[model samples]
Each structure stands twice: as structure tokens, then as C-alpha cells.
Target: MRPLTAQDPDQLGRYRLLAQIGRGGMGQVLLGQGPDGRLVAVKQIHRQFTGNPEFQARFRREVLASQQVTGAYTAGVVDHDAESATPWLASEYIAGPALQDMIAEYGKLTVSGLKLLATGLAMALLEIHRTGLVHRDLKPSNVLLTNDGPRVIDFGIARALEDDLALTQTGTVLGSPAYMSPEQAECRPLTAASDVFAVGAILAMAATGASPFEAASTPQVLYNVLYTAADTSAVPPPLRPIVEACLAKDPAARPTPEQLLDLAGRIEAEPVWPVRIRRHIADCHAEAMAWADGTARSATPQAPAPPKKRWQRLVPIAAGVSVLTLVAIAITGIGQEGTAVAMDDPPLALTDDETRGLDVCALMKPDVLGELGTAVGELVPGGVTGCRVYYLDQSGQKIYFGLETSIPVGETRSGNQPMGTTINWMPVLGRYREALSCDRSVVTQSGLPLALTMTATPNAGNGCPAAERALAAVVRRLAVNPPLRADAPDSVLRMDACTLIDIAATSAVVGDPVRERTPHGCAATGRDGYFAVDIDDRVRPDNVVGGKVRPTTTIAGREVYVHHEAETYCEFIVMIRPTRDDRAEQVHTTYYSTLPDPPDTCDTAAGLLAPALAKLPTS
Candidate 1:
């Protein structure tokens, strides 16, 4: 959990907000301490969203419905205050990482783990359905892997089975595209069966380490959901048939949540979680318990001081002194207007210190992060300060690129032995402390601050050879322009696209959000079509799709290239933050359609871009 920011309230209702665990379109999720010192997750809506009566009513209803769902499989609601200035709800805090994180770390769960996960989810659904609600959003990220068992969470999109809520206009969709059933994908009426299809998709993802319906864009995922069958080929033989049954296209053909529970009874595996996973869970639980004791968890730095000054501190000043102080404040605020901030520092690029041994991952430009934050996900610090790089390989399978600057606490180890012969010169670091292939840590006696690394997950590729190729590319990029440092900054343009774009404002231009996003980009789709805003560094220098890279306009002094093809697609390529000669580290865009025949694409795409870019604090 990240520490609460200065803007965060110290206490919400009876809970003390310790840290911000997550954030979404409507509100923030904080790890809070209840009055009795119990850990709870407090979800508070943003002040702006509270103006919508429909939104307020829907949230109030959902919170009320959630309280009725009490079970081991679900995170039960403990308290809520919808009538407050900012509607908020507090629920049981399960100490675990999201399923997406688990898959990213452990590849796929063991056969034993999968069954346990499915059983818990099925039971959770049965509970939710019994409460007369449908969990509209039930993707991998919605599931948490606690030490005891899996828990379904985030009923924010839930609705009473009978109340449609009119959340979306006629053609717009809801829920995650990759996990949506055929009916949900097509914006048809939903039933309990839609959720069953999603559970099957989740199982396939947990087994194969990716979504069966995942694609390059939102439309693709939706299209796959509507027309193609979920690819459960990689699922374990024992559970494959059960998963297939759940994924059946026809809602009526699929097994009910009760039937799923019966199927889960057949599979068996002791110690439900693998050793590595169990160890991680233990660490998570300990941290959570410690945090409940008032010592906030690791990722938390103390909350920053408020931007506003304390009134008491000004009381001692004279009338004239107070006036001067106000003037100073005004001037300081204006000064922040035209500054580029730290990220724009040209010299602060990633520069290698050969004497300290090569930082291999830094050698190549990594893949652009999508729906997830950063080109990498978790940036772990301390003993081994490093980050994890993720990318879809050529074959579309997700690949990992992990690098850690290791400072071993105890032993001053000697030469390392060969594991896969991929990094023969660089000694094997023993599989990256996690199971990974091509694990290389170049540590000589002189190189005490070791950079332990891994390029791909086990069994995902040519192992060491693939790592070598990725490393070589990094070197090539460095040869062109060396960087100064590796610390990522918080840039408005670099933030998640959903947060960047004003959904309330853009709803007129595009339809409701279908939650179309990548770690680095965001897209919203409706029946008419789709509009997307993406930020990519790859677009710099001649990385344009057709190699027809040419500047067409200057947007707020930054260059832009409008890639418009006849009637089907429109995208405004903008260089938001320039880094080097004619190249930018940040390229923001508004894209409409990958297909053809829509004339209003540019109007909608550019419509959102105009407002979004206007909000950028550019110098």
C-alpha cells in the first residue's frame, strides 16, 4: 500500500486512513484502521462524482446489498455512509495481492491452487446471487489471494438483478472485455450466467498466465468474447472439462454457480498454495497485521504535509506581514506553471557505470506499460532495489523482465555457476529469487552491489538467448543517448488514461467506459465505436506505424502527427514531453477505431484529447 497523500483525510468516519491501497474511476481505496483497531478497506468516492444522484443512489444500494453477503469467499462490508459528503464504504481487509499480481509472479497456479480458487469464487457467486445481486465486475484483479483462501472483492459495479441502473447508454458495454460473456460483450441483458462465463475465463487466465480473449485492443477482446470460444487448451487435464463447461457460449448451456461448486469437489491438492506463494502470503499477512498495530506497512512513506498553511501559524504575523506572505504564495503558485519538472531533465537519463557492472535491463528500451502502471509493475526497493518489466512476446504470451540491484546482507559470495548457459559470461544469480529462466547476476568481488536479473518467465521462451537479445537492444538505445538515472516520476500525461481523461466530460464524445485499458493506455467503447488515448515512447524518432513519420501540426508547441485513414480510423499522435533531439519520452494520443467506415471517429477521439491535453501542466 502507498502512504496516504497530503490530500487524503487522516480519518474517514470511524476509521483512520493509514494508506491508499487502490484507486478507481470513482473513488479511492484506503487501508484504514477501524475504531477497534481492526484492518478494513475504506472506499471513498471523489467529491466530484457525488453530484450525480444516480451514482449516489446506485452506490448506496450496492453497499446495502453487500452487507447481506457474509461468507468466507467474500470480503464482507462492515460499515458505510452514503449520505455523507463523499460516499464511502468500509469492508474486511484481506491480506493478499490481487490475482493479476499472483499470475505475474508465479506464472500459473498449481493444479491444486486453481481448484481452490475456482471453488471459492463459485461459492462467492452463489452468495452474491442469493443476495439478489450480480457482480458485474469479476475479473482477475477483483480476486484476492489471502493465506486462508481466495476472496472475491470490489462490488462497485454490482447491481440488483432487476435494476438495470441505466448506467450505460443503449450500445455501451460494462465490465472487463476479456472476461465478459458473449451477451455482456454485445451489450445484451445480463444474468447470473454472464458471471459464470467470466469465472471460466478467470480460470483459463490463472492456468495459462493470460486471458484467452486478450487482444491488441478493446474491440479485439470484445470481438473474441462475442465470436470465439475461450482457449482453455493449456488448462490442466483434470480441470479442463469443467472450465470448458463454464465457458459455453449459450448462457443456458453453461453450468450454474451451484454446478461449479459440485465440479470443484472432484479436484484435490493439499497445501492449496505452492511453497513460494504461501511464503508471499505469510509476508503479506504479517505486514497487514503489523499495519493494523499502527506501524504502517513498507511501501508507505508518511503522509505529506498539506499544501495549505495552518491558520494558527499565521496568527503571530502582523497585518503587513500577512499581506506579503499572501503575495509570496501567489507568486510561488504562478512559478509552478511553466516548469518541466524533474522528468524533463535531459541529463537524468539512464546512464551505465561499466565499473559497477552492466545494468542489463537498462540496456534496452522496455515495453510500454498498459492498464498496469509504469512500463514495469511493482518497483521493489531496499535489499534489492529493482523493478519488473512486462511485455507481450511475439507469440502474444506475456514475458517478464526483472532486474534488481542486489546488496546481499550477509555473505560475500564468490563465482557463480552456469544454469542455462544463456549468460555464460555473467554468472547465474540462481533464478532471480523467483522462478525465472536466463537468470544472470554479474557479480565479481569488485562488483558487490550486484544487479541480479531475469529476462523471461520459466518455459516461456528460448530463456537466456531471449534475455541476450533484449539486453542487446537496450545497449543499442544507450549507444544513441545515455540516461542519467532510473527514478520514474509522477507526470500527469504518464498517469493511467482513465484518470487522465474526464469520463464525465467525455461520455458525450464516447460511450460509457468498457474498461478498455493497458498498463499504459486507456480506451472507451460504445455501440457506435471506440475512442482511446495512449502514451507511448516508442512513437518517438521514426517509430510511426507505417514508417511514414512526419510532423503535421504543433499542439501547445509540441509536435503532432494525425494518422487518419479514409473512413475507418483516426489518431492524433502528440509529442507531449520531449526528451532528446526530435524525440519525446512521452507521446500522448486520441485514437478512434482500428477498423474502417466511421466518419465521426476523429471528432470523438480528438474531442477527448483536446480537453485532456488542456489539463496538462505544460510549461
Candidate 2:
């Protein structure tokens, strides 16, 4: 949670606003304390919509429907005020990360964890459907994972905004495209089964670490949802049948909430989540409690202006770093345009040739952090090349830094007013300020952005200075003779994904293309089709269960698997070699098009993969 900004109200209705949990397209979710010291998440609609009577009516209906949903797996509506100038609804504030954040931070949930989530979600949906309302936007973000169980939030709210939020040009519905059911994608009248479809998608994500209908663009995802069979092959056997039944395109064929409960059976009483997730929940709860007790500062105090010469960056005092204030920074909502800091220095760009193979998990050692007066804790691995280090500073304040590699700087952010400055001579390509954290990324010679994020306890001051110092230390190390990955030359992590395939030849298969690239992947867009190439460690096609068998063939002495999703998309995966864990390091090339008759899209996917296989390292 973040401190309440000056522009925000100190109190709303009978509750006092303590901090902001998050903000979205509609309004903000504020952490509020009631008269009895109970905490609640207050949802305030954007003030601009106050004058719309239709919107007001819809909000009233939403409040009524939400209040009717009372169940163990759902956050109950504790209070509401629909007649207020800017209406608000206060529900039980769940002090845990969203399912989306959990999956993105930690890897896929374990089998037992998946069962817990499935049972809780099914129970929540049953309660929602019992109230004669459907959770139209039942995606991963709306589900909060707590120690007790998963609690569904924002229930019955999406149906109220459907008409106004639909994307007409793209033929997309109001809900998230990846989780939307076939009927929902087509904008047909939704029943309770639509929520079941979303549950299946969420379970798939929890089991496989990717959505069943994931795609580069929103339209492509919608098309896949409407026309393609969901890929539940990666799901474990125990829950595979349940997921498949729930994802059936025909709503009538989908199982009811009661049936899902029966299928899930009794959830084990022992720990449902892994150790990492439990630790995160404990930290979040402690922070929220600190905010409620007024022990934590609401916002970082502004630092005084620096001298006219070189702008000396002031680091935070968390780890006994210099105590001077940092260069003046105006805090604003992330992605919102703010005053840009003007600097005379040229944009900072570091050489990535030597650092390209640096192992993210080994980049920052615990001993190095301990020397800086920090008690480094567990190192949690995230994506393919990301690591999160959780630790406490000199003052015993909780903090975590997420380090990610090989991300395209363009996709991070560009021309952002607030993030236009430099940090420790590094060009700040992106800046994301949350209630109690700050994130910054810098550009590298390879054009892939290196991300270093610092999140502090609610009471702690600005963490940017400490974050900057850490990044500077990393930069200094990389500039010298830093150790690279000791893994084999053929390891996917050591190779540049773009270099494996012929871009010019692949572009011809689609059309003359405009391209955007990632550190380990290549993507191109044509008038009619979108094409991409990626390398990753995953289960071989033959091992994956419950889906239509992927046709396999040999290309250049490497095993190749062809998987098609209706006429919307096609993909071919070339298996390079098996990892120590029995997972295959594979190259995946895909083609997607929304055109009436996509020309040889699968052929294009195969065309790229076949040549890319020849370039794979034999060692």
C-alpha cells in the first residue's frame, strides 16, 4: 500500500483513508480504517462519472448485488455509499497479493496449491451465482491469495460497466481477453458458466505458468478463445479433466459450480501455498498493519534542490547510505504524465556484450548485500531470467529488489515525463511509483532494458537512492571483468534469439514487416499477420497431457512439434536438447492473423522453425 497523496481525501464517509492499494481505469482502491479499527478496501469511482445518472444507477445495482454475495471465498461488502458525489464501496481488505502477481513473482503453484485455489474459486462462484449475479471479470487479478484461501474481489462489478467498456473496433468484450469465455468473447449474454470458463483459464495459468489463450494482441486472444481448443496439456493429471470440462466452448457443456466442487473434492488441511508465497502474505499483512497504526509515513518526503552544477543524486538512508536528499522528484500516478527533470548529461547506455550472459540469480550475492548492512533472505526466481531478493536494511525495514534481464527498453517506456531523468549516469527508461515502492530500468547496448525495482515498507522513505546505489554497484561490476554464465554454449539463455532465425526470409513468408524485438525473442508485424520467435525451457510435447496430440516430425535432426489453434494462430516448436531437469530447451515460432483467410500461417511458422533449428548449437 502507498501513502495517500495530497490530492486525495483524508477521509471518505465514516472511514479514514490510510493508503492506496492500487488504481485502475475506473477509479482507485484505497486502504481505509473504520471507527473500530477494522481495515477495508474502499473503491471510489472516478469523479468525472458522478454526473452520469446511468452510471450512478449501475453502481447502485452493483452495490446491491455485491452485498448479497456472502461466502468464505469472497470478500464481503462491509459498507457502501451509492448516493455520494463520487460513490464508493468498502469491502474486506485482503492483505495478500493478487493471483496474477503471485504467478508472475513466483512460478506456477504446486499441485496441492492448485487444488486449494480451484476449490476456493469454485466456492466463490457458487456464492456469486447464488445471488443471481455473474462475476463477468473473473480473471487472475481479481483473485487474492491469502493463507486461509483464495478470496475473489470486485465481484458483480464488471457486468455494470460492460456496455460502456466494450472495445468496438476490435470486437473485444469488457473483460480480459485471455480469460474471457467463447460466449463472452462474442459479447453474447453471459451465464454462470462464463465464470466457470474463466476459472479454467486461471487454473491453467496456475498449472502451466501461461494462459491458454495468451497472444501478442487483444484481438488474437479473442479469436483464439472463440475458435480454438484450450491447451490444458501442461496441467497435472488430477485436475486436467476438470479444467478441460470447465473450458468447453459450449456453456451448456461446462460443469456447474456444484459439479466443480465435487470434482475438486476435499482440499488438504495442510499448507496450501509454498514457503515463498506464505512469506509474501506475512510481509503484506505486517505492512498493512503498520499503516493502520500510523507507524509508517504515508509518502516519501520531498528532498531539497541540488546545486546548479552536476546534479548530485541523494541516496536513501535505509542502509546507512548518505543522508542528503535526492534530486527533486515529483511523485505521480504511474503512466501519468508528470514534470520531466531536465538534465545536461547525455542518455546513459551501457555495453551489454560482456554482461549478456550474466546469471540474474547470481548477479547480487547475499554477502555483498550483507556488507552494506542488509540481512539478505531468500532469493526467489521469477521469469526465465529474473530474480527477487528479499532482505531487511540497516534499520530492519523490509525491502525487496527484483532484477530482470533482456527486456526491450521500448516496451518498458519511452518519453515518460517523470522517468526522463538519469540515475547514477544510467538513462532511466522507465519509472513506476507505487504506494510504497519505486521501479526504474536502464537501457543497454543490446537494446534490452535491465530492470531493478526497490519496494520498501510503508513507513520507509524514498527507496530510489538505495535502489540507485545498488544499480550503480551492478553497473560498476559489469563494466569490469564480471563472470558470465558457466552453462554450456548451447544453453538457450546464452544465445541471442534473434540471431537464430533469418528475419528477412521469415518476413517474406508473412509480408514486408515492421519489427519490435526482445532480449531473447524476435517479433514482427505485417498488415496481415504477426510473427514471433522465442526460446525457452519447457515440457516436451509428448510429455504434455490432456490436449490433442501435437504432430511431431524431425527437422534437421531435431524433434519438431506442430500445434495449431484453429485458423487464428499456428506454432511449431523445435526441441534443441534436454535440460538436467528433463525439460527440453526449445525454439518456438508462431504466426497469428485475424484476416478472413490467413495464407499458409502454419507454413510460415514451420518455415521459421526449420531454419532456426539448423543454427542451434550442437555442443
Candidate 3:
């Protein structure tokens, strides 16, 4: 980003321009701050184009359509002024480099990185196409990469710039010819599939550091795009097939964005982007944060964190529930209010430290449900400290069996005590029925609080019987030495997320931060903002937490995915390692600030994660 120039306006609409982020044939993209204290990328059109009747009409229509394009991967249009003297559009300001810039500076992406890039581009296309618009110019430069994923930009105004044949200006085309499809190159009526074609070229470039249709001159490049068969030999074997299919001369031969999404799913690899690319993203984020802090544009070094402290896991503020709690709440209309637990509340039979290594999945024996039901899929990690299994009942209906170890056990003053029961001499808390669900809890011989839940499908009948049977089996197994999780000695689960970052580190963002403990993580609130750390096993950060995925940046020597929520919150997830069930053992750090802009909540989240991550096991 650069300082504003003499020609740039100090303010536009309700935004105050901060810096010139970029400039192209159409106009300039300025980093602007909205009245609500949100950052936006404001695109101001060239004065010359605003007066053109064709440009004005197309701009207005596309702007309206673009407003409807909302998805995880595309930067949705936030504000636009097509009728203004100098029409401009603003979008969520994404803090990362374009694919073109990334590839140019860092060389080609790894095969794994290419697959991630392909998936994000395909998803972005799906969103744009879903809204009845084609990203006419899907090129490396138009694709922005963030920690979460790729975001397609300029969907509306960019297309508006492609009016008459003169817009292409064969002699000086506005868009990159190398990334254009044959139909777009020939100026024929286009379809969403045309963007798919561009995705293919982009993949080829991202994989080989040069577009498949590259040439010495603009005209030559256009000729190659129109007539040449893309050379995918240099592309990685795994991605060549998809790239070839995308580069097919006939737009119809190209795979749909949905098809690409399916293909991308099969490329199962963690730490999505290449290591160097992740570092580059972190560098960009650091620079952006520096600018946000009103510091001069320069490389800012990540400061060393303070001494680590031994943090004990705190009890949940309220008695925690199983993952099935959400389903029950939806069905029973149970409210979360008046659920807080007091410090003097009854203690769990066992503490988290006593059961941290015990795998809840191990205690759930499939044969225990013999004749009554059969375990469906393999035992999978359910929550931060839990596991669950889906069993098919005799009636062919599926029942969910979830077991969470080391959660806070307590009763509210509103008579919310557990129903007394005994299984194999173990104190069992049972039969907390909620519509189609049966809930149970037990304090193990070691004194850890264990909660079990069984949720049945519609008309599946009472689940408490099977729930009790399963709990009985689990309780029985707990009597013997239970199977321990094959976690690395340095596993993140062994660390207390709440205490990961010392109070000093957390207080840097939110003054005098106070801890707000949860089942598997910790959150701190202060006068200025709130920050948190959560650990879990999941495929993607966005899947567990809803947010717009951004670029992957480096934190504490680990690659972490970044996400934003409502422009006020930011989260960074660090993937520790892949587990037995093909899920990631990841740690998530989040920040929410009331300070305007807050110097990028991402910076705060990264700072919070840095200390915690540095102390995690690396095996």
C-alpha cells in the first residue's frame, strides 16, 4: 500500500481513503475506512468511463447483481455508487497478495498448494455463477489468496469495463489474454463455463510459474488462447487432468465449478498452502497490520513472546453439554440463560488432567449394542475432548452416541440435577431426555466428569435404553486401564488453551484481560476487546466456525488459517497434525476488538497464538 496521491480524494461517500492499494486500467483501489470503523477496499472508476452511456448502464446492472453474490470464497460487494459523478464500488478489504503477485515473487506453488488454489477458485466461481454472473476475467491477478482461501474480486465492475470490441483493444487489452477462454478471446457470447476455462489456465500458471498460453506479445497470447491446446505436461500429474479438462477449447467440455469442487475435495492434505507461501502471507499480514497501526510501510518483525506459564484447565463457567446439545436446543427450545455454574458446584469424579490422554472412542464398544444396533462409520473425534459414533438401529434409523470426557459437572439452582443411576457400581447421571435425545453423565473411578448423549432419528423410539447400555459398556471399560490416545508426547491437548498466552500477552490487546473458561478452550475479556483459544480436531477451520476464510499465515513457526466474522472478530487456526481418523488436531485463537480497526484483529489473534503455539508439542 502507498500514500494517497495528489489526484486522489481524501473522502468518498462515508469512507475515508487511507492509502492507494492498487491501480489498473479501469481505476484505482483505495484502502478506506467506513463510518462504522470497518475497513473496505474502495474501487473508484476513471472519470472518463463514468460518462460513457454503455459503461454506466452495465456498471449499474452488474453492481446490483454483484450485491447478491455472497459466499465463503468471494469478496461480496459491500457498497457501490454507480450513479455518482465518479462511480466507485467498495468490498471487504482482503489482506493478502493476488495470485499473480504471489507466484511472481515466490515461484510456483507446490502440487498440494495448487489443489487448494483450484478448490478455492472453483468455489468462488460457484458463488459468482450462482448469482447469474460470470467473472468474465478470472485471472491470477483477479484471484486474491488469504489464510482461509481464495477470494474472487471485481466481479461486477471488471466485467462492465469489457463493453465494445474497443474495450478489449486488441492492441492493448484490458485483461490478461493468457487467462482468457477461447469464447472470450473470440468475443463470442460467454457462459459460466468460460470462467472454468480461465481456472484451468490459472492452475497451469500456478503449477508451472507461467500461463499455458504464454507468448512474447499480446496478440500472440490471444492467438494461443484461441487456437492452441494447453500444454499441461509441466503441471503436476495429480492436477494435470483437471487442468487439461479446464483448458478444453470447447467451453462445454470444461468441468463445471461444482465438478471442480468435488475433485478438489479428494486432494486431502493439511496445511493447505506451501510453507513459503504461508510465510509470504504472514509477511503481507504483518505489513497490513503495520499500516493499520499508522506505522510506516516496512517489514515488521514478529516479536518474541514472553516466558511460558503452566496453566491448569479451568472448569466451564456452566455445566457443559455434548455436541448434540445444539440439536436438542433446536428441538426442545431450551434457552442458554440461567445456566451458569457456581465455583462451589459439585466436582466431577475426575478432572481433565486425569483423563486428557484417555480416548473416549475406545470405551464405546460396538458389540455392546449387539443385536440392537451396529456401529456405522469408524469412531471419529467429535469435540475437543470427545468422540462419537453413529449406530444403525434395528429399524434402520441412525442414533448418535457421543462421549465427552472431563467436562464441568454441576446443577443449577433451578433443580437441574442429574437423575441418579448406577452402572457397574459407578455413579451414573442418566436419562436427561430432551425430545429425540437421551443424555447421561458419569464421574469415572479416576474422578473425571464424563458425559454421554444418544440422539435418535425421528420415530426411532426411546433411546435411553441403548444410551444406558452404551454407558454401561463405557463404564465397565473404564474400570480396567482404558486405551489411551496415541497422541504425541508434545500434543496440544496436553496444554491448557486458557493459559497458553500469559496475561501479559493477552493484556496487550485487551487491558486487564479476564479469563472466561470453556470446555476445551479459554477466552479473555477486557476493557478494549476479547480474545480466545480453542483446540479441536476438524477438517477445516471454517467448518467448525462460520467465517470468511482468509489466507494462511505463519504463527509461532506453524502455518495457520485466518478467518473473519462480521468485521469485528478474527480467528487464526494452527493445524498441529493429522489424527488417526484423517482429521486435523488444530488450535484456534480468536480476537474481537471494540477499538476502531484494532490494528487488524488478525494481528492480535496471531500474537495470542504465538505464545500458545510455541509451547505446543511438535511431534
Best by TM-score: 1
lDDT of 2 by residue, 1-619 (tens): 5677655789989999998776432456788989999988887876755686756775776677678887988878888888988788888877887777677667788888888898899899888887777767676767888888888876434343244234222332335456767766555556788899999998998888778876533345557887889888889888899899999999999999999988887544342888899899898788889889887775465576432221121110010000000111111111112211101111222334434565566655552333234546777654355667866766777776766664555565552223434543445543544335655565442224444333333236776655655554454334322435565655776677767657687677657877766655777777767778776655765565676677876656666787554577888777667775647667777878757877666655666666777777652
**Model 3 TM-score?**
0.45
What lDDT score goes with residue 167 in model 2? 26
Worst 10 residues of 2 by lDDT: 316-325
Better model by TM-score: candidate 1 vs candidate 2: 1
Where model 2 places Cα greater than 4 Å from the true spot, the runs are: 156-173, 266-271, 298-619
The superposed Cα distance between candidate 3 and the true structure at residue 505, in angstroms, equals 90
Candidate 3 lDDT score at position 137:
56
Q: Put down candidate 3 lDDT per residue, 332-388, tens digits, no spaces.
A: 000111111111111222346535666667655463344347788988766556777
Clashes of each: 19, 1, 12
Model 3 lDDT on a 0 to 1 scale: 0.62
How far residue 435's Cα lies from its native spot in candidate 2, in Å, is 27
TM-score of each: 0.50, 0.49, 0.45
91-193 per-residue lDDT for model 1 (tens digits)? 8877777776667666799988988888888999999899888876677767888767788876655666776435323333346556767766555667899
- Decide which is better by lDDT, 2 or 3: 2
